[model samples]
Target: VRPKFIDYYCPYTLGGHFINACNKDGEPVCGIYVKVSVERLNDISEQDAIAEGIDTDWLAESQDNYDCIADHNMSGRPTAKGHFSYLWQSIYGDDKSKCWEKNPWVWVIEFKRVQEQRND
Candidate 1:
């Protein structure tokens, strides 16, 4: 099966949810994002991918939680392993209370989905 790609954004901020809180440059801020392939989403329903989207809570987990399928993999770059890599964004603050005043972090992930073929 061919994989369908999607990009998702997380609405959660330390103070509150996106737009409601977290001010950036005098404007309500939205941060934290991810890129993933949901080839399996179509199997359940045509609109499943669009409706369910990415799981923000799962993506929020520590980077160590995910196994790296590839490294330094990106568009136009030669991939040593998988065809595509996952991408996500995050930020770290000096104090948990001041998450708005934080440093930005980005991640690219690589993974593969394997299925067993059945013969009758």
Candidate 2:
């Protein structure tokens, strides 16, 4: 799960039992596991979609389907939910086990961004 991917994506260093980390560039970064759950991709709600960061202007972490943000929404979504759908589809469209049309059960991780701390 996150343990497999966090290293590749975040690249941090641990601070002993103190539980701290920094990036490859030595810029301090820290995160603690908040929570993780499983849900159908299609069951995502507006609040969850917003929490996924669609409203903040970042559509998807790997989003290249920007047109869907506004244009696809005209098809009856028109909100954070719409953006999230596009993101999900983009990320998991190839495999039936992860496909949006299949409404696959996906691990949902909730992270709360806090104020930056030292590079400890």
Candidate 3:
């Protein structure tokens, strides 16, 4: 089971623990926990939305060009949160407990990526 982010905080959580990963070249990546927090899904910030890889440009351009379903009153310039909300719905659908509109608590983990040479 996927333990909640809180599990990573308590002695039981692996948030602050050492985790290893490798890139395509098999170089070791030292993943060190830097921070962890929780936030409501709908309360995401523009910065966080962008960091999560929302494409505001495409939303705006498509809305301005061929998106007949877009809200007529909207100017088609999608904010980061707006774009993210659209993507969120696509993933979660309208599930009452999990959809973005329900504003569920989510885990936020920040880590430092340090790549090291392969030992072997």
RMSD of 1: 20.8
Cα lDDT tens digits, model 3, 1-120, are 121234246564366554335555655554678999998898889988988887666656663433323632345365777667767776778545557667889998888876565569
Question: Which tens-of-lDDT digit does each residue in 1-120 have in candidate 2?
Answer: 111223333335433323335555665566566998999878989898887667644444435544775556445335677777777777757445546677778898877665765578
Cα lDDT of candidate 1 equals 0.32
TM-score of each predicted structure versus truth: 0.18, 0.51, 0.57
Q: Model 2: which ten-residue window has the lowest total lDDT?
A: 1-10
Error of 3 at 35 (Å): 1.1
Clash counts for the predictions, in order: 1, 1, 2
**Residues 1-120, model 1: lDDT tens digits:** 222233345444333333333333344233323454433211333133223343434434535434432333334422222111222212232334443223223233233433433457
What C-alpha lDDT do the candidate models reach, one value each? 0.32, 0.63, 0.65
Model 1 weakest 10-residue run by lDDT: 80-89
lDDT for 65 (candidate 2):
47
Candidate 1 has a TM-score of 0.18
Per-residue error for 30 in candidate 1, Å, reads 36
Instruction: List runs of model 1 lying over 4 Å from the truth.
Output: 1-95, 98-103
> Which stretches of candidate 3 lie above 4 Å from their native place?
1-28, 63-73, 95-98, 115-120
